[model samples]
Target: MSEENKLSVLVVGGGGVGTIVAVNLEAGGHAKVTLVLRSNFSKVSRDGFSIRSVDHGNLNGWRPHEVVDQVPAIGFGKPGFDTVVCCTKNIQDSTPSIEELIRPAVTPGYTTVVLIQNGLNIELPLVAQFPQNVILSGVSFMGSHEPEPGIIEHDFEDKLVVGAFRNPGTSAALSNARARDFVGHYSAGGKTVCEYTADANRSRWEKLVYNATMNPICAILRTDTATLRLSDSIENLVRPAMEEIRAAASANGYNLDASIAQRMIDMDPMEIFFKPSMCMDALKGNLIEFENLVGEPLRAGKKHGVAMPVLTVIYDMCKMLQWQLKAAREGRSQEDMLKVYDSGKP
Candidate 1:
């Protein structure tokens, strides 16, 4: 496509991270930016989203060009988007709207989809539904949150990694060029973005290794990542889980560095204090993405014959908590779920 024919980008999910990407893109002069939010978040479009950050000081009073609760079900009107960035959660079973929004945008010659979720399961399903050539996987280490409606606080500096899946041989030039453009824009906003290996599974699994060790433990214990980093009890549990994930990664032919956790722990204390998003979701009683974040790794471990006893235990506990939460929502008891969070005592 010629430069004039390149359609603008649309970002699905108007939460903190989504807002950051949208704002930064606009700030970088990418004028044709549209944000598609869930019906519940439409109010943000009118009220506008605000972002406050220690790094950038504060970013508020910015508005998106177009905001809708759903993708244009009637098809992207007139000027179709050349790219769609998905910043939705990773819960495989609860993402129909995200799927619907991405479907039309994946038409072969147009629209590359960039996924910025936390887990590793979203890509396969997307590729199954569309073309692998059009899919891009991205990982962001940025810290952010919504203190209230129309307000997002950026808490930390984050590096972003973008790349394509393996052996698809589908427009590598296009993928790399887009990734470079995205990184440049993010960097301009004082965020770091880079190109990772084409081996997305390895990069994804490496990230999952960290999340599996940190996110759930923080959620179950109800603590910040820093506190977990400092605790002997949490560290004890986490080390074994990391070992299991490392073993699984090895089994899958990906060699992870031994110093990953130490590097993470060595980061500034303020950065460490940033809480995992899952903890935030649990606090709001939102459904957790247990399957993608926890369950998939467990399954992969078993398939590879790698032992992950700690992860298995944590997965079972999280699953039970999720079940109880669902049951309570349907008029059952939440005492058990509450106990899991309390007993672990992170």
Candidate 2:
């Protein structure tokens, strides 16, 4: 395709996943990929990005063709992006919200917005606000993180399970060729494998099976995956929480298999020792990803009348931990704040 005919993709948030997508898409040499890096624009634009992928090996000076501070206004009769991938965190009550962050780039019928964030029901508000846009869901299994600004360390698996967010019991949005084509861009230069499912809700729910259990457990206990796996926490805390989430998903009309809970339990023995994002955030005195990860599931359970007692307790602990950690950041005594937990109070 000519430069004018090439598909344009704008990736918001130049973090780990955003860089991965931009680098791989640019590698394909097919689409015109641009990155919206708000903070690290000067460094990345000058020196480019660096990637240390366990699967793809070390790559230095990897840069996309275009880097801008913000989404440019789509001029009248001027072409807008064909795809907009959001890699930003969906923290609870975040400013500029996810919708406002990407609102400027959405072209309704033209742009396909792929949400590659974590948690449940993260797409509902966007779907409601931009009903004309082709919204797709993506569950990123890519084990990657940014240890420093403008650098990405991708370890272990690199795969994305993606599909259109059709209503429950509805067929996949395979008919949306744009969604299929967008998925293809991820693996354009063989960077990662992208699997398209007819039932994206199943994929999202399946991922929550692991996330709902591990994220809060680790953040609250100040532990890692290996710690949970090696001890009775797997059975006592993780497994029950996963089961409750699975039940909640089922009650919300997404029937996840009971075996998913066991699968997460079983896989813990072979996986790497690491802390989840929520745990890392808490340790670093950052805001916890409260709403989507735990709050949404709990509310869904209540709405559907499904009992999620174990997850309820975990959720409560996470809220308490969040407040205590926030106080610790503001020069409060960590020891005294921890005493709040000692009292067995919320």
Candidate 3:
């Protein structure tokens, strides 16, 4: 496609998932991909990306159309992004939220926002913030990780479920049209699969069977899927958490059957050894997505008076683990954490 005719796409979070998205979109010869980077900005911009994958075999020095560290302002005669795909790790009510982080690049009524992160009802803030823009809920079921700067490893399935995020905010016609458009760009390379859904929240609830349970449990245990599946954690912790999630989602009117959790658990085979993103983050001493994956669901359960005892325990454990991570990163001791606690400050 020519410059004037091609879509301008800005992808935030140039990690494993974002890099894959940018590469696939750029390779498709459809849209112009501008990638936003964080810690790995300096190295990636200079040498580009190096990917070792099960799908797109061994990509070297792969760069997008434009690589930017900071998001460019959308207006004032500069061409704004046609779509912004945020594949970042979502923390609930974080400072400088995902909406604000990507706000400057949003062209108000024009730019469509696509969230390809994990969580339940994560689109609420963005929905409230940018009511005019088309907000897409991208439920990604891929496993690609960046162990070091500029190197990505993809071994899991590259599948995406794309659709309108929540409610009937934008016209149904416009919502479906934009979702199909993104699916077109995303699935251009035959290596990946993308599907469109009218009710993306349902997809999210289904995915929570894995995300809310296996993801957090694996992280807390600091183990891989094979280990977790074999251990007592799967029966004692994982399934019950999934049941709670199912109950909460059903309470909110998205009804998923009881078999869904067991089906998800059986989907991945036992022999294929791999670590989910949360576990990897925990082992790497980086902050894991505790709130988005676990905390928010608990809150929802509380609001609806759903019994989430299993998830409540998991949430508290993950919360302490996250707190310990932060304290460790700052070189603070557990006693120092108690100081903050004893002072009645958060």
lDDT of 1: 0.70
| Model 3 spans > 4 angstroms off | 167-169, 333-346
lDDT tens digits, residue span 51-129, model 2: 9976667788877768998876675887788888898888776678888888888886567888888888888888777
Residue 284 lDDT, candidate 3, scale 0-100: 88
Clashes of 3: 0
Task: Assess every candidate by TM-score.
Answer: 0.85, 0.88, 0.94
Error of 1 at 339 (Å): 23
- Model 2 C-alpha lDDT versus the unseen true structure: 0.79
Q: Of the candidates shown, which would achieve the greatest TM-score relative to the real structure? A: 3
Cα RMSD of all models vs. native, in order, equals: 5.5, 4.5, 2.1
Clashing residue pairs in candidate 3 (N, C-alpha, C atoms within 3 angstroms): none
Give each model's clash number.
0, 0, 0
lDDT of all predictions, in order shown? 0.70, 0.79, 0.85
Instruction: Pick the winner on TM-score between candidates 2 and 3.
Output: 3
State the weakest 10-residue window (summed lDDT) of model 1.
263-272
lDDT by residue (tens digit), candidate 3, 1-346: 7878888999999998998888778777788989999899999999989998777889899889889998878777898888999989986546678889999999888899999988876888898889888999899888788989999988786899999875356777898889999899888777789999988888988888788888888888877778877878778888888889999998888999879988888767688766778888888888888787888778887899998888888889988998888778789977877888889965
